[model samples]
Target: MDRVKGKTAIVTGGATGLGFAIARRLEQEGAKVIITDVDVTRGKEAAGEIGGLFKQQDVASENQWISLIEQVRGEFGKLDILVNNAGISGPVQNADPESTSTDDWERIHKVNGLGVFLGCKHAIDLMRQSGGGSIINMSSIAALVATPFITAYGSSKAGVAQFTRSVALYCAQSGSKIRCNSVHPGQIRTEMHDSLLDETAELMGASRDDVENDFKSRIPMGYFGEPVEIANMVLFLASDEARYITGGKFIVDGGMELGG
Candidate 1:
């Protein structure tokens, strides 16, 4: 808990799933966390549970980010960590690569890729003024491997990986104290996965349980990862424990891409 003592953090999409888990872990580590999510109800609940503040903000919206960062700066004085965890696999219609349209590509790029860019853009300035901070971007194993159906998602996450490195070097070149890193998780058990499993099951005319196991079979771990595992990694990166680490890509996959 002393690792992040006296620190303040902003976690986007922190209402549930991996984001919420990360928020909880940061709070446990003695950081005052502000959870931003589009779902006001869950966001408030999560913040209350974590003893943090809740703000409704869609990460894909640049104007919303401006207001959000301003509010965090005013209330918290300085931001120590920023987690760009909010994202989608793309709209339902465009989830399939063959069916993906230009508009779909653009939308996913805006949320999954551009959102990280904007977060780093605004947070780096604040972190610089405050001396330094850590930025953790939520990528996916798909970014490093083939994703036939989720082509847009895979592409967006690939952009995230490169953008993370670019921003990390930019900070280093500018002598800013901010550190940038990326994390990739494989098939975590979240609502997002549940929905995907349901969709795949329907398409395959199979039970959700059967489809879930089929998905798990591909993982060397023989099970889907829990959100808290990913959260734990984020906590480590966001805390002083990772002071010497920067510009790194940490994979939390359960050996899902072992040979790849």
Candidate 2:
């Protein structure tokens, strides 16, 4: 539990769901936590709950990322962890790969792909100057499998996976202690997944129950996972327990990959 004690961390989209859980876990483990999100009201409340700081941020913007890194370094005196958890599932109606528009692609990549790029691009500088740190990027199982439904989502996540590896190699070659890794989660029951189920049901003209069952059937465990499961994996990566880990694709999917 004290694995991350005295560390400083930032969790994007930490106003709720998995991000909030990750933030809470780190803070509980003795880290200085800062939760960032565009949702001002909920983000502030969530940060207050854990006695952490809240910053309004749109992750896709380079300027905001610069400001965030500066602010965190200014207030905390150093940087240690950066969890690029802010992302979007793309437009629900555009779930069909064939019908997905360029607009939807832009929407998904801007946040899910470019946002992470910016996070790492900026965070690495700060981390390098302050003795290096951990960077955890939230990818998804969709990137590992054949996902025709959420094309944009899967593509963006795939970029994240590769980007993570590239960053890790750069740091190692440059003689820095900074570690970059991607976390691939499958069907975690967060607000994002819940909304995805609803959207799929509406698109298919089926009940939510039917859609949920179909989705769960693919999992070898025959069940969806909890947000905390993903959070725990992130925590492990953020801690010294995973010091030897870098550029690794950590999948916390309840054996779903096995089913495939």
- Best candidate, TM-score: 2
* Cα lDDT of model 1 by residue, 1-260, tens digit: 67888899999999999999999999998999999999999999999998999999878888988998899889878989999999988644446767899888898888898889888888888888888999999999989988678789899999999999999899988999888999999989899988888878887798988998888889898888899999999999998889888889999989998946
Q: Model 2, 1-260: lDDT tens per residue? A: 68899999999999998899999989988889999999999999999999999999999999999999999888887888999999999767856778999988898999999999999999988888879889999999988987668889999999999999999999989977999999999999989899999999999999999999999999988899988888889989999888889999999887888877
Go through the candidates in order and give each one's C-alpha lDDT: 0.89, 0.92
Give the distance in Å from residue 230's predicted Cα in candidate 1 to where it truly belongs: 0.5
**Worst 10 contiguous positions by lDDT, candidate 1:** 89-98
- Give the C-alpha miss distance for residue 16 in model 1, angstroms: 0.7
TM per prediction? 0.96, 0.98
Residue 127's lDDT within candidate 2 is: 89
Question: What lDDT does candidate 1 reach at residue 25?
Answer: 92
